[model samples]
Target: MKYNRLLCAGIAVSLLWVSPCPILSNEQNTSYASPAPAKGRAYYEERGDIVWEVPTHRKLIALTFDDGPDVSNTPAILDLLRKYDAKATFFVVGSRVEKLPHLVKREREEGHEIGNHTFLHSSFQHISRNKALSELDQGQASIVQATGAGTHLFRPPGGSYNDSLVKLAKEKGLKIILWSWHQDTLDWRKPGVHRIANKVLRNARNGDIVLMHDFVHHSTQTVEALKIILPELKKRGYSFVTVSELLSNREKPDGLIEVNK
Candidate 1:
């Protein structure tokens, strides 16, 4: 499962149109505060009914797409998933779902799971408790309107969460779903397609919840990367499932809590 770093570097050099820096990265000379230490799966689980990756031995991976139901990308992504018989969970924006309800409907109709990504995709870390509740409620309402069903999963915008936000999510009967740390493709940054494909292929493992995006502000890197990722992973005997399906295989805890890498 090792990636060829030389090949990836060469591809990046050749793809001159691709940005040399990530879009989300701070500009040069900008002084930003250092980030906090990364939290493990246990940190989230202990805080609330949150899950990053399930502990399991089966070759099951949950592919989750956030910030979507995009007109240009989502349908194509769905087609590719269908081609490989892979099911994914899409955490769609409530506003987008209201406008493009058909796309959300297509996702559910194709056996993919849909989760709320909030009405305005607001970060709960900065908003008030009442605002957070409104985001959750409105987001759920949009999903139910589109698919005629409510979702039990929610992923805060940018993975921001705190004690109050988690409690609010719990009160709404939503489990906060995050991705396995290593499986984030960063496709939203519009990195070269090979890089995105390699990130997932190289780090993929059992019980992984892979984070990808179906909407990326006029970029199709995720869709293009999937063109390579899906078949290659299928060859490796990995079975793609919805987040709910993967969660069903979670191992029961027996006193000691083992940290997931």
Candidate 2:
């Protein structure tokens, strides 16, 4: 997934700090999965990645939002999660953490997981291992400084990861998490709410991880889609969990363990 990195950086540099809130509220409306192989499932074939989806039968799935802590879209997304009683993992950027520290703390207090998404949201392909480590170090520092919590989860910006990046993250006591290819809502494209909803609901399965964002305005549509997805999936007997908790329940052994339970 090639990210609009230049665009993201521009937005970061130009925006001044604002209080976090839902997009539908005033204050300048703004913004902001999965595995399982059923027939016609969107099976992603990424080579050399660490963790994508947990291969399990626990009826658990993880919803992960990336490039966030945005003042515009984050709070509303948080509200929706609480409303649904759904827990998610937020992969937040470092500078965004500095801009909206309260939101990070709020996410922690609300029982959501926060992971390092890099200092400037640099793509893993563009950064060397050392640079990647530095990104996590500084990103985690900001998160800890703001929320009084530290994260062991590291997700490379733009879903671009490599062996060296994964190795360094593990050495730093971090886990590299990517999303289930079948469940990528591509909400960043602002594809309509129904499209996003259909894409996820039609394809998702147990032990999957979903990728989404909290930085675009149309992300409110992502929120709207979640309104439909949450109840529909709950009706289907699916349970929402954080990325770490999903991995914690993985059938474990050594590195990259397979399910055997």
Instruction: For each candidate, give its TM-score against the true structure.
Output: 0.81, 0.76
Listed per model in order, the count of residue pairs whose N, CA or C atoms clash below 3 Å is 0, 9
What are the runs in model 1 whose C-alpha is more than 4 Å off? 1-41, 46-48, 253-261
Instruction: State the displacement of the C-alpha of residue 177, model 1, in Å, after optimal TM-score superposition.
Output: 0.3
TM-score of 1: 0.81
- The collision pairs in model 1 are none
Q: Write the per-residue lDDT of candidate 2 for residues 64-134, one digit (tens) a residue.
A: 88888888789888898898788999999999999999999999999999999888987655444456667
lDDT of 1 by residue, 94-152 (tens): 99999999999999999999999999988665455567778889999999999999999
